[model samples]
Target: MVQNSTDPVGWEHFDHDADVGVRGIGVTQAQAFEQAALALTSIVTQIESVEPRQRIDISAENGDPELLFVDWLDALIFEMATRRMLFSRYKVDIEGERLSARAWGEPVDVNRHQPAVEIKGATLTELKVEEQDEGQWLAQCVVDV
Candidate 1:
């Protein structure tokens, strides 16, 4: 089943049993975090209309990509909650497992970007990063909307 049409960030049931869990996938860890952030944005406002002008860099250890991914999203959330900043587009660099990502977007404008819901947090549920034999990383994440 679906949750709400108002949410801009797309989300689907994790399984047939309960609707508590949802999943989002991307081509890389950075993309995955970007998608997850979009999901949160969709919940808050119309993501399609969110202008992608703000830019910043996010880098962390290579030991745990998952933890880094969470930190990445948290940074975005903090930007919004504290400074009311929102971001679009994620450029991530991963060597072995270390991550250095850059996000591009602009500050949140209540009149312009009508956020639908507040993103409480992004979790580690069903977190995964793998390859499709082509060598490109595929990152999957489930964030709490």
Candidate 2:
């Protein structure tokens, strides 16, 4: 799990055979989504090693929260592959079925980033977006690595 000592928001990875599961926890759905993106980035490189030198905007819409979460991750994966970048920071806004966000990172430096794996896409396996407690939200899914 990736977390700040004073922050309740965090991200984690779980075993999923050949692939991997990414999960995020936060006080709000938007925060959970942002943490999920961090989890995705962590799968490839240490989040602390990345510099937020560039910013990219992303948007996705789906009536179902679970499906929308998948779209968000897949969008990030697409951006990473096409731009040869790794994002370390993210800000997300959710209104109804729509999601709008911005991600910040720099072009991958193999010597510095040391990416462990390339994520092909986010999958529906174990997909979930739910409020687990009165003030806590969780977002998660299995990713094709």
Candidate 3:
């Protein structure tokens, strides 16, 4: 289900047993990828509380779009775990099965941005990347927390 946000491009979370599912919808594949990253961030903390103070570059490649989506999310999860940061903004560029992007946010502030869970990784469960009817693209997968 889509979130109740005013923007046409947005993200949403869904139930997936012990894990959580993150979904992104937008007019373009890149936009959907960006929104999906936001959804991933929201799993950790309130996205609005994460200021875009630093930027991190990330890239991934795969022949299949679905696998690429998993790679993308895994890359973000790796960054978050290693850097101890939470991203609030993302700029994604996709060409074929290759993806390059920049994520912007600050280091985690426990008091200001209370984290809810630590995402271990993105899983193949319910993995999907496709363009829906009406020209909307969607990217989604279940994340292990």
Give the candidate number with the greatest TM-score. 2
With candidate 2 superimposed using the best TM-score fit, by how many Å does residue 83's alpha carbon deviate from the native?
0.5
Worst 10 residues of 1 by lDDT: 15-24
- Clashing residue pairs, candidate 2? none
* lDDT, candidate 1, 93-144, per-residue tens: 6676676777677777788887655666666777665554342344445555
Best by lDDT: 2
lDDT of 2 by residue, 1-145 (tens): 5556336689889889899999988899999999999999999999999999999999999999999999999999999999999999999999999999999999999999999999999999999999988678999999999
Candidate 3, residue 64: how far the Cα is off, in Å: 0.5
Q: What is the C-alpha lDDT of each candidate?
A: 0.59, 0.94, 0.92
RMSD of 1: 5.5
How do the predictions measure up, each by TM-score? 0.68, 0.96, 0.95
lDDT of 2 at 48: 94
Candidate 3 on 78-136: residue-level lDDT in tens? 99999999999999999987999999999999999999989999999999999985668
Report the Cα lDDT for candidate 1.
Answer: 0.59
- Regions of candidate 1 where Cα sits further than 4 Å from its true position: 1-33, 132-136
Candidate 3 positional error at 141, Å: 0.7
